[model samples]
Target: MIELKSPGEIERMAVTGQFVGGLLGELSGVAAVGVNLMDLEHHARRRIKERGAESCYWDYAPSFGNGPFRHVLCLSVNDAVLHGLPHDYVLRDGDLLSIDMAVGIDGWVADSAVSVVVGTADPADLKLIEATEVALEAGIEAGRPGNRLGDISAAIGAVARRYGYKVNGEFGGHGLGRTMHEAPHIYNDGRPGRGMKLEPGLTIAIEPWFCATTDKIKFDNDGWTIRSADGSRTAHSEHTIAITETGPRVLTRRPEPGEGAASQIKQAAANS
Candidate 1:
């Protein structure tokens, strides 16, 4: 069943979102050439412990994945998109890395992901990452009340087409709140004016992930990492948002370089 959040519940979610977003921002800075992927995972685990937040991925045993996920982060490298299992891999210059994370704070859950190029960035890779980011914003903008859920999907698909990227709809976004995955399966591509009508207090995660070549994806031998079928590079961007009377409030919004979590919390309160 589809569940909605009350004002107080949304506020609680915003607090969790702040932590998720802040941690992602910090991880992005820490990701550099020569750094081991395991190091990033350990850093994220430490931060989650320090903040008293619970990792949504730890011990998560989905039907498709291997027994249970034992890590705190999904570190996807070039060509690898979703559910990336971190291994003993060293970062190299020009390698595109994507970090996906979700955490629960005080019973509320927030999930977010970002893609960045380590060390020297290729122009094409940067463009691909930018397209996903722009697509994520478009999807969020379409989450306002009175719009259909497919409207968000259509908006995201349009952005992908505009950027000359093919979208894989198999593992797109979904409704997330008290848990990581909830009802209302959101596709990356769909027709507008279709699906459930948006309503206030409806919170969902809208993620746009794309590959430079084909729209097909395959799983790795580890039974978790998802990579492009054509061996093409990929990028992913996501944000958790709440549909409100005023508009769509982005709960997991990453703060600016100099911005603090207090400011983000204040902004969320003002929006509420």
Candidate 2:
């Protein structure tokens, strides 16, 4: 069943969202060439421990994933897209890396993801990442009150088509609060007027992940990392948003450089 959050609950979730967003931003800055993926994972674990928060991915055993995820972040590199299990791999120049994370703070949970190029970025890779980010924004904008859920899905799909990218229908977005995955399975593509009506207090994660070539995906031997079937590069962008009476409030909005409190947190993370 779909559960709407109250204002107080939403605020609590935003607290967690702030951390998730800031951490992603900081990680994006820290992910350079020669940086090991495991180092990023360690940084995330340290941050979570310091904040007294709980990792939503730790020990999370979904039916589709490998048994009991043991990491705090999902670090996908190159062709790998979702549910990326971080291992001992050093990032190389021009490698596209995707970081996905979720955490619970004070009983509320927020999830978000971002894809970035490690060092020297390839033009095609940057374009792919831009498509996902733009699609994510479009999805969030369409998640306003009274807009049908399909509107968000359709908006995301439209952006993918405009960028000439293929959308993978299997693992899109979903409701998330107090836990990682919730009800209301959100597809990447849908009819604009179809699906459940968007209402106030409704909180969901809007993610747009796309492949530069074919839409087909193949899982790695680990059973967690999802990569493009045609060995093409991919990118993913996600944000947890709440539909309010006014508009969609993005809970996991990443902090821009020089931003206030979030930037301070990013600096602290960098220093640590």
Candidate 3:
């Protein structure tokens, strides 16, 4: 069921969100070429532990999972999309990596994702990352008090289409709260002002992920990691947001307080 949060609940969520947002920034500080994905996972776990927050991804098993996920982070590198399991893989120069994390603080869950190019990146690799960021921003802009869920989807889809990237069919954003995944799936494509309305105290995850080529995907043998069907590279960006009386509040926002639309747009242009 879709349940709304009370004012006190919203305040608690914001607190969890601040920690989650700060964690993403901290991870980015250590994210670079030559860093092992496992090492990054350890860093995240250490930070979350220090804050007395729990890593929700660890030991998490849903209906499709063959077993409990034994890791603390979702490390999707290059062609990998969502649910990328972190192993012993070491990031290299020009590699585009997406790090997704969620934490339960005081029984509230906040999730966020970011796509960063490790080192000196080639032109095409840079373009892919830029497109994902642009698309994510468009989606975020569409999220407001009067807009419908479809408006957000259409905005995100338009950005992806502008760059010739195709949206993967299976995975999209979802509602988030005490549990990781909730109701009302947010698609990458939909009609504006249709479906659900943006209401106060309703938290949702806005994620925009696209493959460089085809829309199809295949799951890794590990039954967790998802990659492009044609082996093409991918990029993903997401933020947990709550609908409010004023506008949408980003829970898992970027670290730098100045990292808003203006700064992000400039970064996207420079990368482009």
Candidate 4:
């Protein structure tokens, strides 16, 4: 069943989301060239422990995933798109990386992801990353009460198509609450005005991931990493949003106090 949060519960979710957003913002600042992928995982572990929270990815064992993910971070580098398992690999200049994380705080869960290039980014890479970020914002804008879930999907897909990127089929976003994943599967592409109706108190993760070439993907030997079939680079952007009587409220927004969109946009550009 699709779960809805009370106003009180939504406040609790926001608290959980603050930690999630803050972590991503901090991690992105240090995801530069020469950093080891394992170091990022350790950073995530320390942060989660320091906040008295638990990692949703570390013990996640979905049927589609390998048993017990065992890593605190999904460190997708270059062609690797999703569910990337951290290893002894060290990042190089110009490598595109995506970090997906989920944490449970005080019984609430918030999940988010961000993509960035290590150093000396390619123009194409920067564009691809920008497209996914724009798509995420578009999807969130369509996630207000009275709209259907498809509206959000359509908004996301439209941005991808506009950039000539193909949407991935296997995974997108999902409802989030006490658990990491929940009901109401949010597709990357769909017809607007269809699917579940968006109502107040509903919270869902809006993620848009796209490949530069084909939509097909293959699993890495680790049994967790997913890469593009044509070896094309991909980008992913995600945010947890709440459907309010007023509008959509982004629970996982990254900008700190006194920071504006210009700064956030600059952060995205710098990552590229």
List model 3 lDDT by residue over 147-193, tens digit each: 88899999988988899888765789889888888987999877777
Off by over 4 Å in 3: 257-272
RMSD of 4: 4.9
Each model's lDDT = 0.91, 0.90, 0.82, 0.88
Instruction: Mark the 10 consecutive residues where model 2 has the least summed lDDT.
Output: 257-266
TM-score of candidate 2 on Cα atoms, chains taken together: 0.94
lDDT of 4 by residue, 51-167 (tens): 999999877888877578898889899999899998988889999999999998889999999999988999999999999999999999998888899999999999999999888
Off by over 4 Å in 2: 257-272
Worst 10 residues of 4 by lDDT: 257-266
Ranking by TM-score: 2, 1, 4, 3
lDDT of 1 at 127: 95
lDDT of 1: 0.91
TM-score of each: 0.94, 0.94, 0.91, 0.93
- In candidate 3, what residue range of length 10 has the lowest lDDT sum? 261-270
Q: Which order, best to worst by lDDT?
A: 1, 2, 4, 3
Best by TM-score: 2
- lDDT head-to-head 2 vs 4, winner: 2
Distance from true location, Cα of 10 in model 1, Å: 0.4
CA deviation > 4 Å runs, candidate 1: 257-272
